[model samples]
Target: MATQPREESANMGKSTWLAFAVHILTASGALWALLAMVAAADRDWPMMFAWLGVALVVDGVDGPLARAANVTEKLPTWSGAALDFVIDYATYVLLPAFAIATAGLMSSPYNLIASGLVVVSGALYFAYEGMKLPDNCFRGFPVTWNMLVFVIFAFPGLQAYSLAIIVVFVALTFAPVRFVHPVRVKRLRPLTLAVAIVWLGSAFVAASDGMQAQGLTGIGLAGSSIYLLVIGALFQLSDRMRARSAE
Candidate 1:
């Protein structure tokens, strides 16, 4: 019977290392994002967005893997959430900010201001305790500046429009609305995952090629964007309905 506790402790030791490996893999995605910025500086759009895509994949899988590994229970000393937030800020915010500023996505002066706004608002959003809702939605737009950067780069003629869009997203960072978390929101997980996959493929297509590719990608982006907006609205309405029922 006494040996049982030792066996459990040994098993936990192994599990903790597995959990830590997951965190390392996720954090490496941030380093990958930084390298993506180097590609951005070289004006190699394909490689830059490719690295971002890799980072997105890492971020997407790590959480599920960590949970399955029982990370928190195995390694109470390690704070996976803090590590995730740090990597998220780098991959989702800082690298995109760098790309926008250097890639001429917006007009000269406005690009700098827009990039700064993204960084500032993203930092605030990350620090906001209410960023994550009880229902697992983001309290506001989740600071997906990387996607915004990809969209802007994919559509060169929209330089003027990009500035306006950036401003709106920055504002939305502080807005009192919920944004659907594609993986976390359980209502339409399969549909959300499908749209996200399509959107990502479109993003790569749009980033790599010319007008024909851009045209198809644009349609995909528009469709996916509408789906996300509708999902967010559904989350809000559902939460309100639940609250009223409780009362």
Candidate 2:
């Protein structure tokens, strides 16, 4: 009777608190990025990436967790997307850019320009209104410098191409290509998610070995990365072909 109203109120408060906790999870990424910054400053690339990986996992889960908790409905005042963007730019762009500039991966002027372009281009990429497409794909390269830098560190051989990589990807920042959002975008979602997991697992193993991914681990990382990078474009092409056939 009277207890029914009390129980319902208690349940409502519980949902609100759950949403608040989700926000806290999102904010925790900033702390991980801070630690990663320290590691990068000390030239400890592996440890820095380990922290970044933790942040990545946090970022991945927080979106769905926020949705499940109905954070937008409960905490309309707080913008999870805004907070996420801030954290993401720091973790995905800023810290990796710092590492590139500091790690001596390239010669003087090239390193200087490449790292500078990373943050600059990353800022523009994330701020652009059309950065993400309606189908949950990124409209352009999406400024994944963190992943690119990790790959460079893993294969030391890529050091020769560091400058070119930056220049090309920076140009691609505004290109017409579609980049996969992995766990989002329902087409081939199971395969995409599996590839993402493989990539993450490979990342962990590489981080453990001082960011040097060798042997089969290297192959797994490369394969999964290629799949993620190309899948969205494949989807876009498939749709275009289907539309042409219909016409």
Candidate 3:
């Protein structure tokens, strides 16, 4: 019976250490965001996207890590979710908005306006109570300006259309559109994860090519993007039909 106390203490120590590691992992994205911001300020699209890529990776895995670490149970006082949201806002919304505003994608005043719209809508979306639906899909457009802006930067041809794209997405933020949480959504998870992985690979390729590509990587990126857009709507349609039939 004497060893019980030692065992419990060891377990507690391990759990506490894991919680701290998860928090540190989540916070590291902020540093990545800072680096991305610096690159954006220099109008270095390739370098900016590279940094954003690292942040994206950190964001992707930290959720699972936090869950495994039992962060909430181990550190009841510290809100991992809140910390994640703060980091996400900085990396996903603010940094991307800054990039858009500075990329010269749109004409002067308009670029600033568009960037402002992105920031405002994304912030609102993050705070929204109904941001996600029961199916693990995002309720609307999901405030993924990082991905959108990355695409625009990758394809120089899309720059001229940046304003239109931004306006459409901002509107879609509340337009009853369904955006899938690639990893969280259960429906078609295998396909979704496979495509998402390919998308990330293409992202690496896109970065290595200095945002100028002429190969399968570019094609894979485009194809995966189109799939990401279409799959959720397809699932939404299925859901609507099931509901109608049940009714």
Candidate 4:
């Protein structure tokens, strides 16, 4: 019986190490962002977006893996959530802000303002309490600057529109709508993941060769956006019903 406790302690030690490894991967995404910036400086949009995609993949998978390994239980001393948010802000907000500004995607004054807005608003959003809804969805737009920048980079003739989008999403950082978490949201998880996968692939292709099936990739991105809109609407409707029931 005493041996059982020892065995469990050994297992927990392994779990803690596993969690640390995952945290390292999450931090490495920021390193990848540095490489992306180098690519951006060189005007290699394809390679830059590719690095960002890698970071996105790392961010997406690490949460589930951390949970599976019982990170919090095993490593009570270290806060993985804090580590995650720090890295996420860099990869998602700061790096993309740099990319848009450096790539000359938007005109002078506007580009500078847009990039600054992304970094500033994103910082505020991270600091905001209740950023996550009660239902585990993201409250407001979750500051997906990387994805927004990718879309703008892929589609040409949208320099003006791209600036508008950056402005709009920055405003949306304070919006009340609940954005679905894709994998974490219980409702429509499979559909959400499928659409996200398709969108990621489409973004990759679009960024790699902006001229290859440009129209089709644009359509795919639009479809993905529509899916998120539908999900957000459904979440709002559900929340309203829950509120009415409580009343």
Q: Using lDDT as the measure, which candidate wins?
A: 2
Candidate 4 off by > 4 Å: 1-6, 211-213, 241-247
Q: Please tell me which model should have the higher TM-score, number 2 or number 4.
A: 2
Q: Judging by TM-score, tell me the better candidate of 1 and 3.
A: 3
Q: For model 1, where is the 10-residue window of minimal lDDT? A: 207-216
lDDT of each: 0.82, 0.90, 0.87, 0.82
Best by TM-score: 2
Window of ten residues with lowest summed lDDT in model 2: 180-189
lDDT of 1 by residue, 190-220 (tens): 9998998887888777766742235667889
Query: Per-prediction TM-score, please?
Result: 0.89, 0.97, 0.96, 0.90
**Sort by lDDT, top down from the best:** 2, 3, 4, 1
The residue ranges of model 3 lying beyond 4 angstroms of the native Cα positions read none
TM-score of 1: 0.89
* Residue pairs that clash (backbone atoms under 3 angstroms), model 1: none
lDDT of 3: 0.87
Clashing pairs in 3: none
lDDT string, candidate 4, 50-104, tens digits: 8888998998899898888877887788888898888889888998898778788
- Name the lDDT of candidate 2: 0.90
What would the TM-score be for candidate 4 when compared with the true structure? 0.90
In model 3, the Cα lDDT at residue 169 comes to 88
Evaluate residue 64 in candidate 1 and report its C-alpha lDDT on the 0 to 100 scale. Answer: 91
